[model samples]
Target: MLAIRKATVADCELIHTLAWQTFPETYKDILSPEQSEYMMEWMYSLENLRKQMEEEGHIYFIAYHNDEACGYVSIQQQGENLFHLQKIYVLPSFRGVHCGSFLFHEAVRYIKEIHPTPCVMELNVNRNNKALKFYEHMGMRIVREGDFPIGNGYYMNDYIMELEID
Candidate 1:
């Protein structure tokens, strides 16, 4: 069985740990080692995670399977009717299971719970990421693509995918 809990500021470290374990592996084939390390520090640093939850309004959820932490997801409202699926990652060992889907649906549930109306959920995925199919399977469609600069001369060449919730 899969369960999800709303994460608190106290869980920042756990999220950081999960990011370290999963993010690199997720992008290993698409990102260089230097770029991956840069992104890890830039996005998953403990301070950054806390800032995201506290100041940035990113609500995070931790997913568990059989009492073991397996994945996490986060959502941030960007507009009155627009939300961003900022992060969704599942550990490699948990891939075959429904961890990713659970997290994805939980993110949408959170958005709908708070907004309770029509909205759009958007997520930026690397153009080469295998998860592109997963997002598409979840009913997201690529609306655009671009090379977003992420500092240190690194660029995230990605496709912006969006799902309309009604």
Candidate 2:
């Protein structure tokens, strides 16, 4: 069985652990080792996670299968009716099991509950990521491309994808 729950600030450590475990594998072939390390510390460090949760309005959800943590997703309102899907990742071992879809639907559900009308849900995905197709299949369309600098001379070369909610 799969379970999804809203993550509290106390879950930062768990989120950090899962992030470090899953992030490298997801980006290993796409990013250099040094870049990956920099990203991990910059994005998933406990302090940053705490800031994201406490001050940045990021809402996180943790997914578990048989009581074992397997994945997580985070979202935050970006505008009047626009929300950003900041992160969504599942363990490679759990891929192909529909956990991604489950988390996605949960995100949409949350958005609908809050906005209750037409809106946009968007995310930034690496242009070369295999998951690009997956997001498209879930009704997202690329709106633009970007090369966002995240410090230390690295840029996130990505497609800005959006899904309409109505």
Clashes of each: 0, 0
Q: Evaluate residue 123 in candidate 1 and report its C-alpha lDDT on the 0 to 100 scale.
A: 96
- Compared with the true structure, what per-residue lDDT tens digits does model 2 show for residues 1-166? 8899999999999999999888999999999999999999998999999999999999999999889899999999989989999999998888878889989999999999889999999999999899999999999999999999999999999999999999
Quote the RMSD, in angstroms, for model 2: 0.7
Checking candidate 1 for backbone clashes, the offending pairs are: none
> Model 1, residue 102: what's the lDDT?
87
Which parts of model 1 are misplaced by more than 4 Å?
A: none
lDDT tens readout by residue for model 1, 1-166:
9999999999999999999999999999999999999999989999999999999999999999999999999999899899999999999999989999989988888888888889999999999999999999999999999999999999999999999987
TM-score for all predictions? 0.98, 0.98
> Lowest summed lDDT over 10 consecutive residues: which window, candidate 2?
90-99
